[model samples]
Structure formats: structure tokens, C-alpha cells
Target chain A: MTQDAPRNDRPRAVNGHAPDVFKREGQVPMREYPKNAPVDFVIVGAGCGGSVLAAKLAEAGMSVVLFDAGPFFQPRRDFASDEREQEKLYWLDPRISDGDDPIELGANNSGRAVGGSSVHFQMVSLRFRPEWFKARSKLGYGRDWPVDWREMWRYYDEVEEALKISGPIRYPWGPDRGRYPYREHEVNEAGLVLARGAEALGVDWAPTPLCTVSAPSGKSPPCAYRGMCKIGCSINAKQSMLITYVPRAIKAGAEVRDLAMVGRIETGADGRATGVSYYRDGKWRFQKAENVVAAGYSIETPRLLLNSSTAQHPQGLGNADGLVGRNLMVHANDAVWGEFDEEIRWYKGPPSMATCEHWNYADDDPSKNFDGGYSFMSQGPLPGDFAGTLTSSTGMFGDDLLEAMGRYNRMAGLKMVGESMPQVDNRVTLADETDELGLPRAKVTHSFCDNDRRLQGHGRKFMSRMMRAAGGKNLFETQSTAHLMGGCPMGDDPETSVTDDMGRVWNVDNLWICDGSLMPTGGGVNPAMTILANAARIADRIIDARFD
Target chain B: MSQPFRTPYPGYDVLDKWDSPSFDDQTREVLRARRDPPPRRFLDPNQFALLEALCAVVIPQRRPEPVPIAPFIDAALHAGRGTGTRFATMPPERDAWLRGLEAIDAEARAAFDGRGFCELVRPKQARLLRSIDRGDCRAPEAWQEMPPQKFFRALLLKQIVQIYYSAPAAMSEIGYGGPASPRGYVRLKVGQIDPWEAPFGTWEDQA
Candidate 1:
């Protein structure tokens, strides 16, 4: 029930990590500048996709400048193993949530750190099912991927290899002939408990393929099973872009300017993205680059694009179609936890290590009243994303709730995330509110559809059964949202979508999007691996593009 | 090395200082407030007393030592903290808390033979709470306009539950591990228990 002072509620300052090898201060340093040179690429947002784009482009010898709105969190010093302390990594941007069911705008929406939400992701790295690519074709709803799974399968493989995804040696459930680069980490006690319960109920459960390392590699070590993955993993076990792609990109000579909020994408009368104006160090600054990659997550990506309106492209960059902030999609996530007689001690390993895809709606489960289906993720049976849930659901409280905390270790929890329909009405727009930075805060408008509620209702019935089989009692359930997608959807039709399959914004040739912003649909799974895969694919296209 | 270790890591560490953080200031302060609460900054003396008595009835923890729910609630209200969402009929947290505290006492006085809420016995206090929860106490201005159930759910019940859990002492009674840094959990497989985790009677039976 504690609504903390929003990040911008004060003139915020966090100390630089003492043991940090990177020369950074107050999210400062690592700048490739006399502040004069026009880099070859200026990528906004240093998150899942931008980190990869910067690294790959820099590796290809493109001079890249990356900008992030929030401070850089140094892993060793900044990342606390405790979830309570590590919540500083969340973005506190001015945001408003409104809908039939308002999405958690505080924590789970998107991250604002230098590494973006990647720094705090739970390391759930499931690829989008190949059937999901054909969702529009096979299922009669949502837009389909212009390119099929076969076209992007190699990119998924490459991204996994680069991220060092550890999974079962033989993944029978892969879309393509996919093999994980590393062996699966051992499933924790909670997973085993859930697996037994799921088995009793005829459900398919497996060790969730995690991007977290299973074995030590360089500074990034194997997960200590600290169960601190969501809090930005300590000991560098979780491969957030901070330790993975951002550092690699920086090592490959991409300059990262943290706490540099990109205000607008500067375009010329020729309608080509020329550069960007940003706010840094209490003043306004401009950085020009040959190419611009707006990967500031879904909301910020479109916000910047919509704010970049000029006389030539007056409706925002490629907004002649009025699709800049249209079609926001977050998973219609729901959960059911049962109080078990045995102390599961759910908070031991990764917070979520087991998933059940029995109800994947991509092929269209006729049993479901809705078109899309849901995948189940096992939680601490404790609440939230402890903190992500903090920002997500606002905490549940009561006499029963107080008693529940006493038995927090005894609850077996499961989360169901199903495909959310991309409704244009559920969108992000410039709110009437603005931060001290004088920038319009993202006015997020999201409402769960009938399809979402129907899918969640279906998942709840099975989740209850699995819990009962696991020797649980007093089943409690609450529905929530996870894995936000589809703000700036990519497609062949520029009128309906924001970017091409290559993530190029229509009307602006050099301006590209390489983040969750480009996703057309949320594919009934965690979107991180798909985002990374699509970014790799987009970066490949960028590398091969013959620019005039 | 990957195996789990117990908390309070037998560490040979330094003394309490301004710079050295054993726990963040906010956490440290909250823990401190749980133990030796600061004087009421938001609620007046009467409001504070009523809240403490109400908390005792709501949570009922008076065995060895009491879990002080009033102080934590006071701090949050003073800081203007809330659940971030509320019933439209209810006012902002600061005003809601002020009026809610006043209304509860008013209800107790009206229902319990002209005695203040804190003056009443535990059973009497419980009766008044049940009455308010059921929207039977309609005299108090705050309860008059809005449904008492709404007030109890959004403010009163939510606050008490939050304050109770915020206390490490309450958490420890339930065999909860204190939030300790540099202490990350390791043993996570089903039928597995790290030494740090609470041992339940059914552990072997479940296995």
C-alpha cells in the first residue's frame, strides 16, 4: 500500500558504483564525445534491442551513440540481491493509467534505466511460437508477421547464442530446429512442486529457458539461484543488456550517455531523420548521427516519434497514417496461488522457473471461449514480481492478507500470460501531465478486452486444479498484466503500422526502431527473446541495406 | 559455492556509520520505527491512541510484545503514501486518514455506551469494527457519505495489514527471513530446503 515517491518526485541522485570498471558517475561517463562528432548511429534507449543493435552495428564498425533517460545501474555496486533495494532500477516517469482494468504503470510497464527493462527482466527467454507468426492467418485476429518464422529462426538462434541462453539440451518444444547454447539450469523446488501438480492435471511443464547463465562465462557467472533475478541479478548471473550487450557495444566502441533523455528526432525538410535533441546535465544538447534507432521501449519510442512532428511530416514522423501511438498490447496476465501445507519456500531459486504452454492460443484452442490463449508461469506463490507487482497490482491488504504474509513461504503460485488483442483504442498518448523536464509524460490507456478476460478465466480453472493436486488449500486468484508489446507495430502497410519488417519507420528512411516498440503482437509468451531475435533480424537488414 | 548460505553471514564487518549502509536509510528507519516509534507527526494524540487500539483489535498480537501498527501507518500518512488507488468517494490519503480516524472513534463512542474506541475492551472494539465493516455505523461523517465497507477496505484494513507485515518481528514469528543484502537464496528445487528457510512439519511428507 506504500506508493513511494515517484523517481522524479525529487532531484534524484544515486552514487556511482565504487567497484564499477566502467568510468561512470551519476549515470555519467562512457561518453564518446567532445560532444561534437556526428556518430554513424544514434540509438535511443539502451535496452534489450538497442543494446544489441548498438553492439552489432559497432561490431560492424559503425560509430554508435546510445542515449538512455535513466541513470546507469552498475551491476556489482548498484544491484542489490534484495528486491526492496533494487527497485531503484525502475522508471518513475510521469505516467497515467486508465482503462476498465488499468495496467501497472509504475514498475512492470517498462524500465527507464540505461539498460532499460532488461536490467530487471526475470530472464524468461521463450521465443515466440512459429504458430504465433501465423496467428493472423490461422487465428482470425491480430496482425501477422510480414516475415515468417523460418525467416527469423536463425536470428533467434544467433541472439540466444550471443545471450548464452541456457535451456534443456534437447528442446523438443522449439519452433525451429532450435537447440539451446547451454544446458538448462536445474529447476528449483517450487518448479518441482508445480511440475508434480501440473503432471497430476495433465499439463506440460518444463525448466523455463532462461537467458541467465547455467555455467560461468567471463564476468557473467552461472545463476547462484539467488532468486534475485527480477531485482537485477547480483554476481552478474542474469544477462541483462547492462552486463551483456551494452558492455559489449561499449567495448566495441559505442558511446553510451546515460541520463540523456532523447527529446525529439530531428528531421530535415527532406523528411530523413537527421539527428536528435536531448536533455543532459541541466541543459539542452543535440547529437547528430547518420542513422537513428528509436528503441526507447514502446511508449517512449512512439512518444519521441509523435513529438518529432515537423512541417514536412507534420503529423509526427510517418504519422500521416495516425498510427504513432496506436495499438498498445500487454499480455492479459492472471494468476492463482494456493496455500500449501508444505513450506514451498517459493523465494529460493529464480522467481519464475517453470512454465506451462498447454493453452497456447496460436493454433486456436477451441476449448477457449477466446481466440488467443495463455501460457502459465509459476511464481513465489508470494506476490508479484514482488516489486514489479508493487508497481503492477498495488499490494493486496486485509486481515487475511496479514495472515498470508506469515505463510508466504507456503503458497504455491502460478501466473498465466495469454495473448492480448492489439486494440487501437488501447493506446499511449501524450498526457496532460508533464515532468519537470518539460516533456509530456506518456498517457497510457489500456483496457482488457473480452478475449483477454475469457482467456484468463480459462487459465484460472486449470491453475486451481494444479494447485489442488499439489496439496494446496484456500486458493486465491488475481488477474494482472505482463510483457507489454505492440505500441509501434511493424508491418508492410505503413498506414496500419509504424515500422517495416526491417524496423524502419515509414516516411523516414534512416530512422529505425529496434525494441519492443516494433512488435505487432505479443505472441502468447514472454517477449524478451522475441524482441532480441527481431532486433538481430532488424540489425541484419540494417547492415545489408544499400543506402544511397 | 552455488549452495545456499544462511543470513547474517558471519561477516567480520564494520561499525554503524553515516557512509556505510548495513541497510538503506528508509529500511533502517522503518525497522527503527517498528521498534521505537516516533511521536505522531500526522495524527494527534487521540487519533494515534484510537488507531493503536483499533490495530490491536484488527490484528490481535499481544503475546510477548505488540507489533505497533500505528507508527508505520502514521509515517506513511505523514509522508502522504497510499495504495495509489482509492474509491472515488474517499478523499486523498492525508484527509482520508484524518477523517477516518476521527470517524472510527465517533462510531465507538456512539455504539459503545459513550466510551472512546481506545477505552473499550477488545471484544467491544471488535464489535464496533464489525459494525463499521458492515456499514451499520452511519453517524461518523466519513462513514455517513461513503460506504463504511469501502472505507475499511481501502484505508483502514489495507493500512493495518500493511503495517503488520512491515514489522520484521511479525515476519520473524512466521519464520520469515529478514531482508538481508549480500544474502541471495540458492537451493530452489522442489523438496529442497536451504538451512535459512523455515522448516515446516510437512516437509518430509511432501517429499
Candidate 2:
């Protein structure tokens, strides 16, 4: 743990070490490894899944090396209050977006730096609804996850404790879980507006379950409500992977190599994984390992597998069934904004402060037009993003845009995380073009189905009604997407999935896949908590099967 | 056009907190650099002048000194700071901007007796822009492979709006609490305003 506190009410550093990094009290220094030497495990992508798995494996007396393509940022120095400057935190490398309804990538979904999307993600932590795991078996649509929801629930509790999540004492949704690790954050006007709408609509609402600490925890301070959660949190209060698992992994003798882009997973004639070839410091080098794990999330994971085609696995390491990049899914994050006469000042706290999962219980309400469901939350967007929203949504410019923006403080919005159908056509393939690193870029193709369109339409109408009921005016909707998933789904049948329940690649024994890429269905909730929980479960299975 | 685009929070300047605890040193540095226009690297003098005129139409400013939106966008393009992804049919972001600007000029010259976009009046310029926004522009050759509406929506309007709103003056006009760091907001209820936060209405007398 870091030893320093906020001194003189001013941040100490501009860009190097964290402000709290006076020393790691009673902790060992971070481990380092030689390139030619073989560690027990070589993990790709040091973000939510990779960082957590590294910490777990290292704690179990395993030598591990985690690699990320982006720089390991020190938040105090790197995170700027300005939105444009903070764009550095996102994956700004070129990717080709195509298909009928092409999804806009970056900022909303992908991240580049060490903590990955977690560094800039709005810290809304939520567990997957129990029925979501058995979507096919219980709800009769989408694929059922290989893992049981009951077991996943226990892992969710563990992750909440580790991250010190702040939430309501008794969550009003899903199965009865115990209290959160910390007290709930104070609800701002945006949240109050959401609560008013929920009460008018006669639905349950609660303080958002967030990874950000409400009160001081360990070396970190409480969140000051700077309202820059989606940007990099400079205060170390957000409890992102940068402040949590990454440090633990380092303390437990794991070597994290950032600014190192892994190009391919090296394989041998015996059909077992040997090591990884990565580029760093203007040179291409190889790091030998006993086992290789690809935790590069949705797009990069499948891209890495497809790019690493070998003689034995000509189609890709885990693409023998051609399911590696199939079924790419994204949450339908459609939003409805309205103007109120009262002072709404929506940018006062963490975005998505209050949320209602009433619509997510699809079984309870059989009147829905779609198989899956959605949940709506109050939003707190920064001015830059709000201006962009108004411009895109209404095509307002000059005087009209200025008039709309004059009421920025009086405007509030509700955004939904609606579930979209996972179709095989929505997949990531290698584009003809290459990136600055001379690697083939990912070409993502996606389009919404009729069911998804209906769900979105329903959500917009419902949210508009709620806003109007709560004394709002001039309501409008904007279509968007967030939290990319699928591409390497974990399922029981190897023919239909890329990995098994434990994220182990079906055909490749020594290779594994972790992160959001392994999710079979994109649940109607933020996937950060679920992703971290899944990573924890995978780490345990790996530990148990060490003898093999 | 409507009420002359009045600011609700008049005289509430966000830069008053420039030296305050609310902004960290790096944030202060970034804002300071943004205040001054960087040396032009990407666009030539003619293209740069056209960009300035186009940005003014996208976001009209009444201040004595408007925020430098064109220079920042040019710098971003010079550094190859694309939004990471683009439409498969469109060229790179830089090339698209080049084509779009050229098309705007072509439309202006054809419509207004061989006059360039910079030489046109405000109403005429806005009309040409609206034509492009509606994809009704007849100058197809100037647009080349890029669609006029697509270029306008994806690049021109988005970048201009983002750049304008990111400035401290625009944030202040919108009554945003610039950057909350050492001292964050309290009293978060409806109609509640912290001491340092900009009030909802004009605070000109107080200032």
C-alpha cells in the first residue's frame, strides 16, 4: 500500500509516480524477468482481467509476466481535467468499423493504457442478473453460459470486497446479497431527477453500486465527486485496476511489462504453446512461458488469435471451429435527455449515480416485445461530451446549439444498458490495413437486429414518459453502444464456442482466454464487475489444475 | 437568432479557479497551453483561414476573443490524432477534412459568382453549410469519394463543437464547475450550489 496522504490540499506530482507512492509499506519491490527465461505464465493485456489474474496467480506462488500494448500511466500526472487531453487514455489506434449499422469505437468502449478501459470507465459495478446466465435455458433466447450463476454470485461478492464497492445497504434487484463493502455515495441532482422519474413510474431505484469508495479505504481517499469518472481519475479514489489489482500483482512478484505490444503467440511442433513474440523499445523479442493466456478483451483477443495462425492451427490458435471472432455483442446504450426549469447541474458527481433494473427482469414482465431487457441510469456528462451529443442528436449548430447549450446546467439524461442479440455476422476480422506497429488492424462489423431495435424504441419511449412525468420538457433520444463483449465466448460445446467454462481454449491445451471476450451474452448491466469476477474464477481454476 | 444567444451565467469566468486547488498542476498546464494558438503545422494558410471561417459558423462567439478551435483541430490532425476508428468507405480523417473543405469552397464559388467560402456573407456561408449537412450540395466532384453529410456529421460539426465547449470560457458560459480536484462539490441536491460553483443565473453584480 502507498504511504503518502494529500498534502497541503494540492497534488504533488504532475506525471511520474502516484501521489501516494511514498513507499509500499512492508511490501516487496516489483519483480522483473529476463526475456529468454521462461516464467510459469505469460499473460497478454494488463487491464481488468489480466491484472486481476496476474495478482491471483502470483499470490499462488506462480511466476507471471503481464504485457500491455499501452503505457502504464501514473494517473496524477497523466489524467487531465480537460476531456480532449484525457483522450490519450482511450485506444486511439485506427480500427475499421463497417456493416449496416457500424458501431462507433473508442472512448465509449476501448482503452489503451495499462489499466485498460477500467482507467476511464464510469465505475458502475453491477452483478449479472441470475437469469442472464441461463438465457437460453430459462428465457429461451441467446446462449446459456457454461458456468452457473450461483457460483458466479460468490465471486461477485469477493470482487466487491476487493474493490471496496460503495452501494445501497440492501440492493433492490436480483437475489438477496448482503451489504456492499462501503457506504453509498451521496446522490446528486441528476440522481434525484432519476429517482423522481422512477418513483413516478413506480419502479425500484437505488444508489449505483460503484467501485469508487465513498469513504477513505486503505491508502486511497474518498471520491471527491470531481465528476470526471469516465476520464482518468487523478485522485486515486476510484479504485481502478491501476490502484487495486495492478499494485497487488506487482507486490506479489509479478512482472508487468507495459508499452510492449504482443504480436503473436509462439507455438511448437508438439502443439503446445511455448511463448509470445512482442515489440518493445524498437525491437521484436520473445518471452518464453510454460502457458500463454490472451486477455486482450473483445476485439484484440480474437485479432491476436487470428493473427497468430500457425502450421498446426492454420486458421488461428483457437479458430478451428471458426468461432474465435464470432458473435460480437455490445450493450445498447441509448439515452434520453430532457430540460428542467430547476437547477439540475448534472456534472456534480460520478456519472450514473442512480439506476433502476426494473425492466431487466424480463420473466417478471412477459409483456415485452424482446427476449432480453435493459436498465436505465442517470447520466452526468461533461460539457464537451454534452455539446457533441446535442450536435449529433439534433444536428443543431450556431445559434440553435448555443441556445441548447445555455441550459446545460438544467439538462439531465437517462441512459440504458440494453441487451442486444449476438449474431454471427457481427464479428472482428483482420483488415487489409496495418497500424503504426505494423500489425493488421481489426475490422469490426456489427448491426442491430429487429429485437434490438424494438428494445431500444421501447426504452426511449419509456424514458421519455418518465422524464415528462417528472416535469421535464423537450426530451430527445440518442442511439449509442457500450461495453463490447463476445468474440471468444465460453460455452459447453467446443464446436460453438472458442473456450470452455474456465476460459481455456478448446483445441489448445496450454493456451487460455480471459476478459470480456469470453462472455457468452452481454448482460443488461455494466460488465466491469462481472468481468473481474470471471477473471477471479478463472484464476482459481488454473490454480486447482496446476498438477496437470 | 433567438435571444442573441445570451449566457445564463454571465460574468462567471471558469479561469478564476486557474490557480485554485480545484485544478491540479498538469490540468493548469493543459489549459494554459490551449489558451494560446499553437503554430500551424498541418493546414496551409488558405485552408487554415477557411477552417477559421467554417468554425465560426459552427459555433458563433460574441466574446472579444473567441477560443481558438481551428488551431487545436489542425494540431490534432498534424499529430494524426484520429478518433481511433473511421467508416470503411471514408479516407483517413485528415484526407476527409481536406476533401470536405474543398467541397465547401466549391459549393460557395458555384452558388455566389466564383467567390470562395471565406469571401461569402454569414447567411450565404450558413446556407452552403446547411446544404452540405442535408447532403443537397450539387458539387459532387469536390466531395470525391466522401459523402457530404457523412463528412459534415462525423468530422466538421463534431470537432468544432467539442473544441469550443472544451474551452474555459465556453464551460463558464454553460455554468460548468470547470475542474473539481482538492475541493469537490458538496450540497448536491436540486437547486443547490456550492460556494465556488457558478450560480444558475447572472452573477454580474456579485462579480
| lDDT leader | 2
Q: For residues B102-157, what per-residue lDDT tens digits would candidate 1 score against the true structure? A: 78888888877778888887767767776777668746564547556656754676
Q: Which docking class does model 1 fall in?
A: incorrect
Worst 10 residues of 2 chain A by lDDT: A1-10
**Two-chain complex of model 1, DockQ on C-alpha atoms against the true structure:** 0.19
Interface RMSD after interface superposition, each candidate: 8.9, 6.0
Across A1-548, the per-residue lDDT of candidate 2 in tens digits comes to 01011221122221222223313222235667777888999999988999999999999999998888776666776677989888877887778899988888878799877778999999999888998999999889999999899899999988999999999999998999899999999988899888998899898899999889999999788998889998878888899987899888878888877777899998999878899999876688899999999999999999999999988999888998788899999999899999887878889889899998888884656557887889989999998898887777666788878888888888889999999988999999999988877789999999999999998998888888888877888888898888899999999999999999999999789899989999999988989999999999999999999946
Cα-based lDDT at residue B107, candidate 1: 88
Fnat, one value per model: 0.20, 0.72
Which regions of candidate 2 deviate over 4 angstroms?
Answer: A1-28, A362-366, B1-3, B202-207
- Least accurate stretch of 10 residues (summed lDDT) in model 1 chain A? A10-19
